[model samples]
Target: MTTLFISDLHLSPNTQDITACFVQFMRNEAIHADALYVLGDLFEFWIGDEDRSEFALLIKNEFKTLVASGVPCFFTQGNRDFLVGQRFAKYTGVQLLGDETVIDIYGRKAVVLHGDTLCTQDTQYLEFRAKVHQPWLQWVFNKIPMFIKKKIVAKVQSGIRDEKEMKSLDIMDVTPSEVIRVMEAHQVDLMIHGHTHRPDVHTFEINNHPMTRIVLGDWYQQGSVLVVNDSNYDLQTRPFFNQSI
Candidate 1:
């Protein structure tokens, strides 16, 4: 059996084409997988569990079906959807994992995370992350009225869009030193994460042992997936709407 990993779908109601692709993926590829790990950013934005959009409901129902089909599902919080709490977990039957969680896969140990924390060089965004990730702040945000919450989220998303335009590409990506440091601490042979939206399989050596880092891509123009079994690991992609890479 193969285990699957994906992230950065960034699904939203407006992106019906991508949503259809995701639905097809769940119904086809995922139904037969041994397990599925969503690194994070499954949705474009997730307001607390108390509030959900029509598309969000659709996605949740799909997850429910996927889990019922016998494939275990796991999720971690992302920069965009950190408010995925207990209610969402119950609705989809997905096991919520911490930002950095390690698990044994098929025989080898691997570390998985949403991958934003590695971008330590982005000082401003790091500061913002620290503030929003505080328990007190998250609780307060959740307590706000749904309408107010939407406005706040929209504003923040807009601000992020503008901010990204001003930042250099390197600053927005992971810091290599941080990646090695975190991997060393975990003592893992493989690391899987998605946040940079740059999909690739990278090889490195840590303590004289071979290590691999698999970066998952965003589901903007295409669908990206990593498949792993007892013997081999493969990265694959398909056109989202048939244009090109």
Candidate 2:
């Protein structure tokens, strides 16, 4: 059996093609896999479980169907969808994973995460993340009216987009030191994550131990996936147009 990994779909009403693609993936690809791992950014923005859109319900039902087929779905919260909680998990039948989770991929121990913490050079973003991720702040935000929450998220997203335009690419990408530290702390040679939207595999040695990092790409213009089985792993993508039903 094989396991599939995907991230950064950013699914939303505007991205209907990607949503269709994801449903196709669930039906044709995920059903055949041993497990499915969504690293992060599964949605453009998830305000809260109570603010479910029609599109959100559609996706949730699809996830429920997939799980009912006996394929387990595992989700790690992303910067955009950190509010995913027990209600969402119950509806989708997905197991919520911490940002940093370790699992055995076959016989190899692999560390999986959303990967935002590795961008240490993005101090501004990191500072904001620290505050937003605090339990007290999240609790307060969750208590706000849904409409107000929507406005807040929209404004923050817009600001982030504008801010990103002024930042250097190097500042946004993962820091080498942080990556090494995380991998070593997890005691794993293979690390998988998504956030920066740069999909690639890097092989290096850390503390004399060979290590591999696999980055998952965003599903903006295309679909990206990583499939791992007993003997090999493959990274592949399909165009959004081709993905449409």
TM-score of each: 0.96, 0.96
Residue 42 lDDT (model 2): 97
Residue lDDT tens for model 2, 186-222: 8899999999999999999976879999999899888
lDDT of each: 0.90, 0.91
Query: How well is each residue in 109-130 modelled by candidate 1, as lDDT tens digits?
Result: 9999999999999999989988
Tell me the lDDT of candidate 2.
0.91
True-vs-predicted CA distance for residue 172, candidate 2, Å: 0.5
**Clashing pairs for predicted structure model 2, backbone only:** none
